[model samples]
Target: MSLAAETREAVRARPFLRDALRAGLVNHSAAATWLAERAGLDGDSDAIAAALRRFREDLPAYETDPRAASVTMRSGVGVVDDASDGDGNRAGESLLLRVGDAAVVDGGDRTAILATGDVDVAALANALGRLAAADVDIAAAGVAGDALVCVVSRRDGANAVRVVEAALDAVPVDEN
Candidate 1:
């Protein structure tokens, strides 16, 4: 049987594997390692790679951002339709606040710090104020780093962006 057919069978047998793949927990090497460990079979790396290739080809592709630093804003309302990206594609909309230690993997060790969160404007403003009080510099804003992401649920979707923008704008920008 073909590798794609085999992978489909495997996924059908183990549905969790699909979630693992979506969550980025299992790639080609990882799957091989897992199978080798579980079945006590000496699976070659080449076989694992081929299986992964087949799996990818057989599955429906989902849109994802490759850049690690992207910020996404999503609404809480379940019924709100996603905005069109102008290319007949509906963008994946999710509100996420993320903070991470930014470091270049290929280059020498240089790093910057980042903090993010998806929350109500009042709460976000309060948090920002505290950070400002502690002397953290306000960096970028507006769909980028340090930018305020506003997501409106289907119920409150009409003024989501405006509300978020206003709250973010109220914060003092450091000109230094």
Candidate 2:
């Protein structure tokens, strides 16, 4: 394809680049040079810069939509391999989730932050990003239907809950 097409594809493949372009926060010439090396685009730097300029015009402005969700924290959660001596099948302390061989069971060393109500993958993604920025290490995380859950160390539970709530309040959405 043309250099313009290639540049567009490269930017779309990198969300940060796309966001920068949409916000008009990047220098076209510098971005072109970076893209040439990063995306292996073979073209004159000036031409690639021109392409980036054009591509930026085509992308929609960046925006965020608040997700209506309630966040809650639950302690004593842990992840285990469901196949381990059938311990994951224990009664009373119910299982939060089981994926493949791994299962998040109740009553463990970790804490779980659960967000329900109009929550989806995007909300979860935003929450995860905020959690990472806050230096909270996630043990297990998932979003299905209206439920979004993140398992983290017990010490980080309170901070993770706040980050998740804030992230859900302004989940990013890029319109095309």
Candidate 3:
């Protein structure tokens, strides 16, 4: 049978295997072994082995598209100050800045362009500019702390990957 067909059959034979696969606990072979061990069955290794091979073959279909991946950064600083309360009690004040997810989408896909991280506004703008220069469509953008979040999209798959890569590269590396 074809790999897809074999995978479907394997899933049908053992529904719990789906959870195991999704959880990343084991591949098809280990899942089959687990099932066999639980059922106290022996000499069924061949069947399980075949099913695992088919599942492995079909894994590429479920893999994330590299072109769709994005990069993001989150960085920030904090400050504390001493203060006096109305009751004459000592108190402290705190301030913080956090950068959320920055991403690139095709038009308005909403998928992040990069993993989230803290980045500076200048670096973020430079990245955005680079993406725009490459003709990557930007849906939205925001800046938090030293980080910038940008959404970029492109009609071509290759272009999307290029844009995301360029934007990520524009982020400045910390020397300290």
lDDT of 2 by residue, 27-91 (tens): 99999999999899999989999999888888787788998888999999899876344654656
- Each prediction's total of clashing residue pairs, residues at least 3 apart in sequence or on different chains, is 6, 1, 24
lDDT of 1 by residue, 4-108 (tens): 455555654664575455344567777766655654434475675577656755554332222212223342322223333565333454223222322112111
Q: How many angstroms is residue 68 displaced in model 1 relative to the true structure, after the best TM-score fit?
A: 32
TM-scores of the candidates are 0.28, 0.89, 0.30
RMSD of each: 18.8, 2.2, 16.5
Off by over 4 Å in 1: 1-7, 22-25, 39-42, 62-176
Best of the two (1, 2) by lDDT: 2
- Residue 102, model 2: lDDT of 81
TM-score of 2: 0.89
| Cα distance off (Å), candidate 1, residue 174 | 47
Clashing pairs in 2: 76-108
Superior candidate under TM-score, 1 versus 3: 3
Model 3, 92-143: lDDT tens digits are 4222222232222222323334434544554556566676787766555566
